[model samples]
Target: MTPTFSQLIRSPVLFLAFGFGSGLAKKAPGTFGTLAAVPLWYGLQFLSPLAYMAVIVITFALGCYLCGAASTKLGVHDHGGIVWDEFVGYWITMFMAPAGWLWALYGFVLFRIFDIAKPQPIGWADRKVHGGLGIMLDDILAGIYAALVLQGTAYLISHF
Candidate 1:
């Protein structure tokens, strides 16, 4: 049986999976969830590259478990309200990005585009995979795509 909203709120895992309640937004829950990640990204920017990578790895592992558990409780797969994937994805996109609000904003826009567009392999994974890994894989791929673009853009700006 699926848990009610009240029950979902009571569980710590569900709450984080829900993006600290940002996923509860009546409209564009995914957008809100991604927005909620901005602050987190800002703080994470303080870490060294190695530490940042470690944190992301940890977060991704936890996201897989938390997302799976939450989906099981809700009796749904890849529910829109579960946005822990978004958090990790955005973090991945912003990794090693230029240090500034502008770069952060760029990463945000790029991540959202790749995530929503689900281009090529991202779309393939979203269609073929299931459960927690499924929920996380597409977003991870999207983040990679966005990171490539962001990094390329940064390189061009520096060289040109």
Candidate 2:
């Protein structure tokens, strides 16, 4: 059965899948969802590389289920309001990013672009995949793309 807005907000899984209510925003919910990930990225910055990776893996796994559950509850596939994928995606984009608000901001911008643009394989995955894995794969790919660009930019800035 499709859940109502009130039910979604009250449910723990849905609340998270919805980006802590950021996804509830009527305007640019995806943007807001990505913005919400910034603080989480900052908090995660202190972890060791291995630990960070582990967390990312776990979050990705959980996001698949959380997002899938929320999607099922809402009776829609990849609903705009289901933004846990955005959260995990942004976190992936910022993984091991340089220490600074500037770097975080850059990661945010790049992630949003790649995610929204859905170029090449990312778009392919979006079209071809379904269910929980489908909901998470495209954004994960977008995060990887953004991460590559962000890392490349950081590399250039540091080396030059």
Candidate 3:
């Protein structure tokens, strides 16, 4: 069925709910979904870094509330359409990367690896939490892991 534009913009909760659908894509949907976040991320760039981080924090908080409701409404836990979490998570991933294509590419690869692999704390959060926060926290941690790696990689590349 075609989703209405309103359904597309879903009450804040449903908007995040739609992000989960990205996970449902047959291949590389998560990467594509994360890439979709770039526009929003670009919009956030006008804000000071602190302000940008604050927006991400707020998005995450809202994600938990809305994503949970949408999941229950859809009778699915972490349904694929709830990609707002990915948006937020990936934005957070790019938080520390250098502002360039190369760094963005590295951030994307690292974020995807940590996200898909669910390494360490990410895996723990994925397993222990439920609902929207559970769905989002894993990616947030993965983003953090990606950011750290990207930062370090940048430092190394500069020295070489």
Root-mean-square deviation of Cα positions for candidate 1 versus the true structure, in angstroms: 1.6
Model 2, 2-46: lDDT tens digits are 345687678998888988888887888889999998998888999
- The parts of candidate 3 lying over 4 Å away from their true place are 1-12, 19-28
Estimate TM-scores for all models. 0.95, 0.95, 0.84
Q: Return model 3's CA RMSD, one decimal.
A: 2.8
Q: Give the per-residue lDDT digits (tens) of candidate 3, residues 62-157.
A: 878777877787787776655667787788888856777776677777888898899798889988999878978888899888888887888998
lDDT of each: 0.91, 0.90, 0.75
**Which RMSD does model 2 reach against the true structure?**
1.6
Q: Residue 45: error of model 1 in Å?
A: 0.7
